[model samples]
Target chain A: MTKKLMKGSEAIGEAAVQAGCHLFFGYPITPQNEIPEYMSMRLPQVGGTFVQAESEVAASNMLYGAAGSGERVMTSSSSPGISLMAEAISYLAGAELPVVIVNIMRGGPGLGGILPSQSDYFQATKGTAHGDFRLLVLAPWSVQEAANLVQDAFDLADYYRNPVLILGDGLIGQMMEPVEFADSREPIKVLPPKTWAATGHNGSKPRSVINSLFLDPEELERHNFHLKEKYDRMERDEVRYEAHGLDTDYDVLIVAYGTVARVCLTALEELAEEGVKVAMVRPVSLFPYPSAAVREAAAGAKAVLVVELSMGQMIEDVRLAVGRSKPIHFLNRVGGMLISPDAVIDKIRAIEDGSSEEVRHA
Target chain B: MLETVFSRPDALRDVTTHYCPGCTHGTIHRLIAEVLDELGVRERTVGVAPVGCAVLAYNYFETDFHEASHGRAPAVATGIKRARPDLVVFAYQGDGDLASIGMAEIVHCANRGEKVTVVFVNNAIYGMTGGQMAPTTMPGQVATTCPLGRDVDMAGHPIRVSEMLSTLRTPAFVARASVHTPLLAVNAKEMLRRAFSYQVAGRCFSLVEILSTCPTNWGIPPAEATTWLEKNMLPYYPLGVFKTPERGSREPLPLEG
Candidate 1:
C-alpha cells in the first residue's frame, strides 16, 4: 500500500514473497546475503520455508527440487556463487523447471571483489553452463526495478516453464530505494497449472517424473529443439528496453544496462547541457536482448557507445545488433571499479569532437 | 480357488531395468517399493534418483520421481519435503553420489534433521563410471582406478558414513544394512521400512546405507560377489543400527558378525 524504502536485495526478497514465492534456497555470498537473510526472517511468518543450503551447488538443486514439486522457489547469490550453480542451472534448464535466480554481481575471474561489476553478462546470457537451453535474463538498473523484475521473473518463469534470472550488480543489491509492491497481492499473469509437477498422483492421475536425462540421441535432439522453441518465443514476445531522447535528434546512442545505464543517464543530462545530444537504450531483458531497439536507435545516431562494468562483453551483442552500420565505441570499468559520470561525459565529448580515437584505447 | 501370494509390489513398475545381472539395485528397489506399499504412502511418495547405476531409478518406481544430479539427491529431497511436508520424500544414492561428491549435502541434511529418507547404496566402487574407486572403497581392494589393490597409503581410508553421521548432534535414524544374502536382504527391507517410517511420522532425517554388490564392476561372478561381500567387505562395514531417536546416546549399536 505504502512505499517502503528498502535495500535492493531485501526488496527483491519481499517482492518474491508478495508474488507467492514461499520457498527460498540460498548459500551466503557477499553483496547478495541480504536476500537470504531477509527470507530467513520473513518466510516463517508467512508460513513459508527458507533453507540455508551448504553451498551454491546444493542451493540450486534445492530449487530444482522445490520447482519440481510445483512450488514457486527462488535463490540469490553473487558471481562466484553463481558459477558454482552452473551445473544445476543447466539441469534446471534441461528439466524445464520454473525457478527464479538472482545474481547480485560482484567482480571476477575468481573471487575478485565484493564491489559492483557486470562481468557476468556473458555468463548470464551466453554460457550459463553446458546447454542448448537459455535462461530468460532480466537486467534491472535500480532497486525498484530489481524488485519489480523479481516479481515478473516468477511469472515469466512459470509462463515459459523455464528458469528466469534477475541479473543485478552489487550496487543494485546494496543501494536503498523506495519500492511500491502492489497492495492487492495478485499474480501479474495467470499461469498454466503445473500438471507435470512431481506432487504425487494420489491414484487419480498418472505419476509425474521431473527429469532431463535423454539417453536416446534422437529423443535428446527433439528435446533440445523443444527448448529452442521456448527461447525463440521469448525473443519474439519478451523483448523490453527503455529508449531515451529517441524522439528528438541525437548524435551518439549509448547502449548500457543495469547500474551502468543509470550512470549513463546522469552523463546524458550533463552532455545535453553541453549541447551534445546523446540518446541511450537501456535493455531490460538481457537474453531477449532488445536487439531491434538497439539497431533502430543506432540508425539515427552518428556513432554508438556501449558502456558496461566489464571490459567488453555486452559490446559483442551491440556489435551484432548494429553490424558495422556505424562506428561503435566501447567504455568500461572492471574489477569492482565504478564508472563515474565524468568519465562517460568525457567519452561522449571525445566521440562528438571526432577525437574518439584518443579515448578509444582509454 | 488358488491362493495368490508374493506378487510384485504395487509401487514398482513392470518394465525391465538396465542393471547388469546380479546387481543388488533391483533388490533394494523392491524393498523400497514394498515399504511404500506397506505404509500405504505409494500415492503420496516422491523419489529423487541419483546419477549412478540407478540414474534411471525414476522409471522403476510407480510413484512421482525426480532425477537429480550426482550427489545432489539429498538437497533435492530437502526441497521437496520442505515445500510440501505432507508428501513422503526419499533419495536413492550410491557410494560416489552420496559419500563422495554429495558428502556435504548429505551431512548437512542429516545435521539439520531434515524430514526425509535416504537410501544409500554403498557398493565400494563406482559402477556407472566403470569400476572407479569410491570414497567407501575398501582398503587393499582393487578397482579400475586402483589397479594394484587400493593402497590405503595412496588413497585415503574408506569412510564409514553411517557411523560418522550417527555422531551428529541432531536426531535421526541412521543404520547400515546389506542385501548380499537373502537373510541380509530381509534385514535391509526392515531397515528401509524404519527409515521411511521416520519420515512418514515427520520425526527427523533418516538414512539406510545398504551395502550392495556390483558383480560387473567387482570382476566377480554374481554368486561369488555375495561371498566376497561377506568375507571381505562385511568386516570393514559391519551391519547395525548407527543412530535412532530411542537411542539418545551417540554410540552405535554393537557390530554384527
Candidate 2:
C-alpha cells in the first residue's frame, strides 16, 4: 500500500477499516475528534456502522455490545471521557470480551484542559475500572506507529479475548506524519465460530449466552485469579520497549513514552554532542511496563530521569521499577503543556553537575 | 397436544431465574423471550442487560447478552443493531437505571431513531440498592429514602419517562403497561412482542415500559404492592401506548427534531 501523510487520529480510523472494524461508536472530545469524524464518513461508504453516542458512558457500552456480539468494535476518547468509560471497561475485561479502545490522553484530575498530556498512565495501567483486570495498553510515539498499532490492537484484543488500549497523547493525535496503510485484504480475520456469534440460530445449534456474572463469592474469586494469571502471561510475553545507547555507560538514563519518547530521543542526541553520555528506554507497551529493561538500564547509570508531559504520574512507575538501587529524578510540565528538549537537557546537565540535589524524594 | 400458556420459550435458557419471589423481572424477561421466539430471531438477536436488579439477565436469556452499565442499555443496543443490521437488538432496564442515571442515554437513543428495542421496568423505586427513592417515585409516595413521603417542593416532581420518550419524534413505538395481574402481564407481553416486531419490520426505535412491582422495596406484601401501583403509581403514570409511528402516530410538535 502507498504511504500518505495523515494525522494520528485519522490514521487510526484508516487502520481500523483496514483491520475489518465494521463498527465505531464514540463521543467527540479534544484532539481525537477526527478519529470518529473520519469513521463517520468512511464507515458508511464501506457499509459499516458509526455513531456519535450520547456520552462516553454510552459509547463504551455500545462497544461492549458490538464486541460481545463478535464484531470488530472500537471507541476513542480522551481523559475525562476515558474516566466515564471506566466502569464499562471493567465489565468488558471481566466478561473477557475482545474490544479495542483508543485514549488520546489530555490533562486532568477533574475536567482538566483539552490539550495533550500523559497524566493517565496510572489509570490506564492500573485498571481504570473497578475489579482486578488489565487492558493490553500500547503507547504509540508517532503517527505511523499509531496507525500500525491500531491494526495490531485488534489482533491482540481477539487473541486474548480482552480489551486493548492504544494510549497516545493529544500531540500524537493532532500531529501529522507519513504512514504506510495496511492492505485491507491482508489483515487477519479470525472470527469466532458461528456458534459463538449471535447471528440467529439456524438449524445447527441452540442460542448462545454471553455474560460476566459470577455471583458466588468463591466462583468470582476463581475467575479473578484466572484473570491475574492471564495478565501475568501478557506481561511476560507481550512487553515491548525500545532502547537507545544502553550498550555503553551513561551519565543519565531517561524513561519516557508516547510523544515524550521522541522529545527524549532528541535530547539524547544533543547531550551526546556535548560529551555527556545519555540513554533512554521508551516503553511501547505501557501496561506490561518494561520494568526489567528500565531496571537494568538504571543499574549502570548514575541517575534516572523520568520525562513526561504530566505532573509526575509515570514517574511513580519508574521509581517502582528502579527500587532503591538508583536515585530517580523527574522533568515534566502539566496542564496542557509539553517539556521542551532544551529543558530536559538542562535537567540532565544539572543532575550531572550535582546542582540538582535530593535525587529521590521518598 | 395441549398448548401451554406460559412455558419458557426456546429463546430463553432453562436456567432458574435469580429474581426474588413475586418480582416482575421474570415476567418481563419471559415476555421478551417469547417475543424473540415468535419472531424467529432468537439465534440472531442480542440483548443488553442493564444494572440494578436485572443485571444477570444475560444468564437467563439463551440468546447473546451484553451487560450494560446502569441505564445505558439503549446505547449498547444501538451499537449492536448498527453493527449487525441483520440482527435483532433490545435493552432491558429498570427505573433507577433508565430514568435516573441513564436519562440522557435513553432520551438521545430514542431521538436518534436507532433500530432497536427497549424493555423498561419502572417500579417507582430503586430495588437493587435496598429501596431508595427513584426518579419515577410518586409525588407523595413513601420509599426507604423518602420515609416521610416524597415532596414535590423538596424532591421535585416525578419524571414520566414514557411520556417524555413519546415526545421524541424518532421512536416508532412507545407504550406503558402494568404487570400487577395475569391480565395486565398479558397486555405488557403483547406490547413487548409488538416492539420487537417493529424492529424486525425496520420501522424505528420501539420501547415498552412495564409498571412492575418490587414487593421487598415497597415494604408491603406482593399483593399490596400491586395495589399500591394501581391506586397511587398508575394515577401519576397513566398506562397506554403514547406513540406508535407504524399506526400513523407522530410525536407532538416543538419537541420533535
On TM-score, the candidate that comes out on top is: 1
Question: Which tens-of-lDDT digit does each residue in B1-257 have in candidate 2?
Answer: 99878676987778898787768888888888887888888878878888999888888887776777777888778777876888888888999999999999899889998889988899989998998999889887788898998999999999988888887767478888887888877788888888888889998899988898888888888888788889988887877788887553453222111
**Minimal lDDT window, size 10, model 1 chain A:** A353-362
| Candidate 1: tens digits of C-alpha lDDT, residues B12-100 | 99999999998999999999999999999999999999999999999999999999999999999999999899999999999999999
Model 2 regions more than 4 Å off? A184-207, B1-6, B247-257
lDDT of 2 by residue, A1-362 (tens): 78898988899998998888989999988878999999999999998988888889989988977877788899999999999999889888988878899999989989888998998988999858888889999999999999888998898888778899999999998998899974555434454553554555554775555566788999999999999998998898889999999998797899999998899899899888888999999999988888999999999998999888877777777888998888788888989888889999899989988887634566
Query: What interface Cα RMSD is found for model 1?
Result: 0.6
Segments in model 1 whose C-alpha atoms lie over 4 Å from true places: A358-362, B254-257
Alpha carbon lDDT of residue A58, candidate 2? 86
Docking class of 2: medium
TM-score versus the correct structure, for each prediction:
0.98, 0.93
